[model samples]
Target: MANTNLKHSSPQGGRLRSAVAITAILSLYSASAMADGGMASMCFFITYMKQIVGSVAVIAIFVWVMGYFEKKAVLADIGQYVVLGCMIAAMAGWFVSQAGLVPPSCSA
Candidate 1:
């Protein structure tokens, strides 16, 4: 009697699984995208960015303090850029939040 205990191997090198996973993810995203006009996702992104801005600002301040003790002008310069980035990110987040205040003219 011939042994038939071999495991089945896919010929497509996992592509089939990857394709199915991508399709499922896209379907879920589309369903979510249709809900709330995407406000939930936008708010989530805004909140995340706000947190990141705060964290980056603190790190930049720490960098500035370290530069002060090290007396390295380069570190101070880098810190300046890092702080500038945090400020810009914060401003962007504020702008997005404020935009939510006024309803669109086309909305009924």
Candidate 2:
């Protein structure tokens, strides 16, 4: 009899599962933050945006370095560029919110 147990054999799979879990948790937190409007919510939103921007920057740099080494696929490069664009848009939105351009209900 042969027994095949492959669930824990792939590190990449484990990492992917962990990433999904973290994303789900953060999304729930974000929803709650939106629901709770106040100075604390504003601060949480800003902090979350900053964390996203930082993560994007890190991923972009990693992809750039990998591309330089000719180890990354073109699709990865494109994805990184897309993420960079989103990061830029997010930063702009944050600035606008800070400038009181956003609705008081959300920004306050």
TM-score each candidate: 0.53, 0.49
Per-residue alpha-carbon lDDT of model 1 for 1-108, expressed as tens digits? 743554655547468878999789756765675585665555444455566679989999889879878998888888889999989877775675578652333121
**Candidate 2 lDDT, tens digit per residue, 1-108?**
533578646788779989999899888987898787665666786678767777777777777777767866784677578677867777797788788876555543
Per-candidate Cα lDDT values, in order, are 0.70, 0.73
Candidate 1, residue 66: Cα displacement in angstroms equals: 0.4
Q: For model 2, what is the alpha-carbon lDDT of residue 33? A: 87
lDDT of 2: 0.73
- Which candidate leads the pack in TM-score? 1
Error of 2 at 85 (Å): 1.5
- Worst lDDT window (10 residues) for model 2? 1-10
